[model samples]
Target: MAIAWSGSLDFTVERSGKSLMGSAVSGEGLVNVYQGSGKVLLAPVG
Candidate 1:
C-alpha cells in the first residue's frame, strides 16, 4: 500500500527479480516503486 500526502509523486508496479521463477513458484514476485518528492507512506500487506 502507498499514500502520497503532498507535492508530487509517481507510483508503479513491476515484476520483481524473483518473478523469473513464475508466480506459482515465487509467490507472486512483484514490487512497488515510488518516485519523486513528497510525504509518503508505504506499507506491506500479508
Candidate 2:
C-alpha cells in the first residue's frame, strides 16, 4: 500500500534480481519502486 501526502507519487513493480538470488528466498522476483516528489507512506503486509 502507498499514500501520497503531498505533491505526487508514482508506484511501479518490476523484476528484482536481488530477490531471485536464492531459490528458498520466498519472493516472487518482483519489487515495488516508488518515485516522484512529496512524502510517501509505504506499508508491507505478510
Candidate number of the best TM-score: 1
Q: Write the per-residue lDDT of candidate 2 for residues 1-46, one digit (tens) a residue.
A: 6644445767688776654565236565666777877787667866
Candidate 2: list runs displaced more than 4 Å: 1-7, 18-28, 43-46
TM-score, cand. 2 vs. native: 0.46
Clashes by residue pair, model 1: none
Residue-by-residue lDDT tens digits, candidate 1, 1-46: 6644455867778886655777557676787777788777667878
User: Could you tell me every candidate's TM-score relative to the true structure?
Assistant: 0.53, 0.46
Residue 38 CA displacement from its true place in model 2, Å? 1.7
The whole-model lDDT of each prediction reads 0.69, 0.65
The positional error of residue 16 in candidate 2, measured at the CA in angstroms, is: 0.7
Candidate 1, position 45, lDDT: 75
In angstroms, how far off is 37's CA in candidate 1?
Answer: 0.6
